[model samples]
Target chain A: MRRRLDMQLDELNELLTHMGELCQVAINKATKALKNGDVSQAKKVQKADMKIDQIEKDIESLCMKMLLEQQPVARDLRQVSAALKMITDMERIGDQTSDIAEIVISENITESMELVELTQMAEAAGKMVKDSVRAYVNQDLSLTRKVIEADDEVDRMFVENKKELVEYIAKDKGKHGERAMDLIMVAKYLERIGDHATNIAEWVEYSITGIRIEGN
Target chain B: MRRRLDMQLDELNELLTHMGELCQVAINKATKALKNGDVSQAKKVQKADMKIDQIEKDIESLCMKMLLEQQPVARDLRQVSAALKMITDMERIGDQTSDIAEIVISENITESMELVELTQMAEAAGKMVKDSVRAYVNQDLSLTRKVIEADDEVDRMFVENKKELVEYIAKDKGKHGERAMDLIMVAKYLERIGDHATNIAEWVEYSITGIRIEGN
Candidate 1:
């Protein structure tokens, strides 16, 4: 029974890692589409979200099965339940990535927009997602802490991006207000993705130590 | 065993209903703050969020206890798990309500901004939250469907609000662009609150029918 539970836990870790990788790909695709004004890549990101959603369902079913079959106790139960919680956050990351792609496609955002802070925010958020999943799979407490701390950076970038976009609109005399608003929305989405990553890290900590942080 | 489980489930229902009421109050306070430019009310919303978060923790502990002590299976297990999922969305509703209030406080938005569509969106989203919780507590499928359908109206209102805000900025020659952008963010937050409510309704449906909806 112990070995079987370990096997199932390993499988759960793999599926979660795969889900995290897909989110990273979607974020990367969306960011690239925004950079190059590539509508096709944006379309691909939206299309790939279906796979992410499907994987979430798969993970859910597995968690349910583990709960009903293994009746895992203590740390093992925490690991399974935590997977259930983590997938929700991972799924939202996929949704937000698709949302960014949709904005890029619909807004027809050109590569000409000065998106320095936005790009940094995307990269930072994407890394957090990756690191959070790594922490979960490796059960690395330090890496989980790092992911949580990194959210402050993404948030700072979001605020800085908002300020810069507002200044850009002010200078442009509102000629580009709609476009700047779209960019701001995109930044907001990235910030949310960072938040979901932080949530995933917190869940990872809970699974490892059986201690849920307050106000998460 | 069955009677004990029933008693525990009733307790869970009471806790959830209480949490839902707190979220409604937060939403009402935020909306009032926006409409009246009441920074103090906005601050109240922020302070009240701690209570919402605490209630979510309470619900989580109860669910874990039910799962462990009762060891519920089949439909009973589904109900317990659904409660687990619903509280996450409920907690998010509280967070989004607080976010709207924060925007109101920081942006110092006045009631004279021609915010017809935003006001409409807030009312509609709040109703969806209310109806979704009612549906869950009553196990009413039709009401769950109603909440799901209401999301379309909120989505429509969001689009209309965005278009109107953009036009308003254009008319003001970029003078009110900052304020318009802030309103747009507020609308987006309300729209997300509607989405979370829809998710809760879906979980309620799952708890009732054991048929989890796809692509929630």
Candidate 2:
């Protein structure tokens, strides 16, 4: 029974890693679509969101079954519960990526209008997501802390981008103000993705240390 | 054992209801801050968020204790797990409300710039949140569905407000364009609050009926 539980836990970890990879891929595709003016690529990102949702459901049920059957306790139990919480953040990452794709398609966001800070922000946020998942699967507290700290940089980037966008709109309202607003929304979404990554990392900290970071 | 489980479940429900009320109050305070340009009111909203976060910690530990002690299965298990999921959405509602308050404080939003649809949107989102909590506590599938459907109206309000803000920026690029953009952000946050409320209602459905909503 112990071995069985261990195997199931391994499966849970694997599934979460897969979900993380999917989100990273979605973020990449959405960003590339924005860079290349590829509407079809954006559509693919939206379509891929359903798969991410499906994985979330799968992970949720798997966690439930482990609780009902294995009835894990202590550290084992923490791992399962953490997975339950982590999946929600992971799902949100997918949803935000889809939102970005929707904006790309609707606004006809082209390569010319892409803000340099926005792309860098996406890269930072994506890396955070990847590292958060890695920290969870590896139980690496250091990696988790790194991911949490990286959130500040993404937030800084967002503020800087917002400032630039505001100035751009102020200067060229008739030309690209609407598009700048859309980019602001996109930047906001990416910022949110970073937040979700931080949440996931925090959950990993909870699972490992049994202490949630205070004053969140 | 079953009686004890029932008692603990009741406590969980009551705690969640209390959390919901806090979020409702936060929304009210944030919206008032924006309308009144009372930075202190916005500060209150930010300060109150810590209390909400503390309550989330309480609920989380209680759920963990129940899982470890009661070892609930079947519907009782579902109730416990669903509460876990519901609290995340509840916590997000609080966060989004805080975000609105932050915008109000930083942007110095005032009654003069308040869009008609934005106020109405806040009201709709708050109602959905209140009703979603009621649905969860009452196990009322009909109310859950109602709250879920109400989200569409809130979303429509967001889109309408966004369009108006875009036009407002285009019309007055040098004057209040930045404020208009800030209002758009506020509108988006309200829309997200509505989304979180819908998620809570869906979790209610899952707890009551054992069938998760599809294509969310």
Candidate 3:
């Protein structure tokens, strides 16, 4: 039974790690599509949304089944729950990708807006997602803490970009307002993705230490 | 065992309803405090953040326990998963309320100056939350759909308010640019609460009908 539990956890952990990779790929593809004004690619992201949704549901059902049959306790229980919760963030990240794609498809974010800062935010957030999952799989507390701290930088970028975007849109008043709002929301969405990644990191900390993070 | 499952579900659902009520109240308190410049009230909302977090942890543990023991199938599984999912949104709504309260406490939203529209958005969002929760507890799909549709209005208000606030703050430039950005974030946060309410309503629909309503 112990060996089987370990085997089961390894499989579930692999699936979760793969899901995180899929989310990262989706975020990158969608952001690239946004930067390049590729409506077709944007549509592809939207079309692919169902895959992420289905994967989350599949993972959820599998987790429940494991609990019923395996009766995992302590660290095992934490792992399953973390996977369960991680998928929610993964799905929302997928949705944000879709939102970014939708904005591109609408042809509104077409302004040759130098999005260097926004890209940085996306990179930080995506890295956080990746690191948090790896941290969970390896039970690396330091890596998880790193992800949490990176999220603060991502949020700071989001607020700074939003402030600049608001001023840029205000100068033009409605001409750039719509697209600008979309960009801001996209940044906001990514910041939220960071927030969720922090959540995953916190769960990792809790799973290891049995001490919940403060101010989650 | 069947009776026990039913009773556990009833308790879970009741707890869900109460959490939803707390969400509505918290959002209302935060937004009113935003408009009225009531820093003390905002501080009170900030303090409630921990309560929401505690409730979320409680609900999460309960759901896990239920899933572990009952091995619920079909409708039962849906209810448990929906409750788990709804609490994530509820926790986020709580966070947004706290975010709003903190922004208000900082006096930034007031410095941006066009407050009436945001107040209206808050009122509409607050109402949507009430209806969303009612639909969840009562299993009223009609009401659930109504809340979903109302999100469009809330979203529209978000756009209009952003535009107006931008224009208003543009007049002063340096006077209000930074604070205006925070105000926009606060407005976006309120809009997100409405989005979460719609998400809860969708989960309610799924809980009742076992049909996933992702889009349309």
Candidate 4:
């Protein structure tokens, strides 16, 4: 029974890794849609969200099975529960990327500088999400810490983008104000994606180290 | 040992209720300060925040003890984890409220109708929070639904206030513009409080029913 339980843990770990990969793919495609102005690519992202949602449901069902059939105790329960919570944040990050795709569908990006910056932000957040899940799988406390530290940069960029966009609207006086607002919101969405990734990283830390890191 | 375990659970329940009361107090005091332009009261809310932080830490420690000593599985684990997650959002609401209090201190709100509307918005949010926590404590799913429904009203009020504030700024630029911005921030803060309370109520439902409520 113990060996079977370990096998189940291994399977769950692999599923988590697969979920991380799918999330990365969604983020990369969303950013590609923004860069190439590819409406189809953006639409592809929207359609692919159903798969991400399905994976979340699968993970939840796995967690439920582990709880009911395996009856994991101590750190194992924490691990499964943390996986359940971490997937929630991952799915949210995917949703935020879709929001960015919708923004791409709305406004014309005559210039590439803003789109480039936003893509870099999204890429940074995507990398954080990947590293956090990897760390959770490996139980590497130090890697989780790095992911947590990365959130500060995300927040700073978000604030800077907002201030600049607001200033642009103030100066232009309704000229491209809507577009600028959309840009600002896209940045805001990326920043929140970073936050959810940080939440994932913190969950990793807690499942291993039993510490809750928030607001600091 | 069973008696001790039950006692610990009771203590935890009491502590959670205490935290809920503190959140309500913070919301009330912060709104009152913003409405009355009471610097002293604002300062008091700021000062009391440290105490809230201490309570959060204390609760976390209790949760850690319960998890380690009692080896709680499934439902009990979910309860403690949800409380931990809820505390993070509750503390954020408090910080945002403090931000509003500071804005009132820094910027005068002498004659802005938007400020008045924001205060009412905060009151609506506070009522939702109070009701939701009550529902969670009682396991009253119907009351929880009511709390969730009230969130739409708070969100509508926020939008109405934001639209009117924008009009106020556009019509009379630089006249009460700063105060209008402050009022807008306060409204955003209260809306966020409603969001967090909704999350807590949703968790309560899941704890009872094993069902997930998306974005509740």
Candidate 2: docking tier:
acceptable
Number of the top-ranking candidate, with DockQ as the measure:
3
**Ten consecutive residues with minimal summed lDDT in candidate 3 chain A?**
A106-115
Per-residue CA lDDT of model 3 for B129-159, tens digit only, reads 8888788778899999899999999989987
Which residue pairs in model 3 clash with each other? none
* Candidate 3 wrong stretches, greater than 4 Å: A46-49, A65-85, A102-112, A209-212, B1-19, B36-114, B133-149, B195-216
Order of candidates by TM-score, top first? Answer: 3, 2, 1, 4
Q: Could you tell me how far off, in angstroms, the CA of residue B162 lies in candidate 4 after the best superposition?
A: 7.3
lDDT per residue, candidate 1, B1-216, as tens digits? Answer: 559999998999999999988988898888888877789889999988889999999999999999989999988898899999999899888988887887778775545456677778888998998888888889999999999999999988887887676666666634776677777888888988998999999999999999999634
RMSD of each: 6.0, 6.0, 4.8, 8.6
Clashing pairs in model 2, backbone N/Cα/C closer than 3 A: none
Worst 10-residue lDDT window for candidate 4 chain B reads B172-181
DockQ of each: 0.20, 0.25, 0.35, 0.08
Arranged by lDDT with the best first, the candidates are 2, 1, 3, 4
DockQ, candidate no. 1: 0.20
i-RMSD values for every candidate model: 3.4, 2.7, 2.3, 4.6
Q: In terms of TM-score, which candidate is stronger, 1 or 4?
A: 1
TM-score of each: 0.69, 0.70, 0.76, 0.56
lDDT of 2 at B129: 92
Q: For residues A148-202, what per-residue lDDT tens digits would candidate 1 score against the true structure?
A: 9999999888878877776666566346767777787888789889989999999
Winning model by TM-score: 3
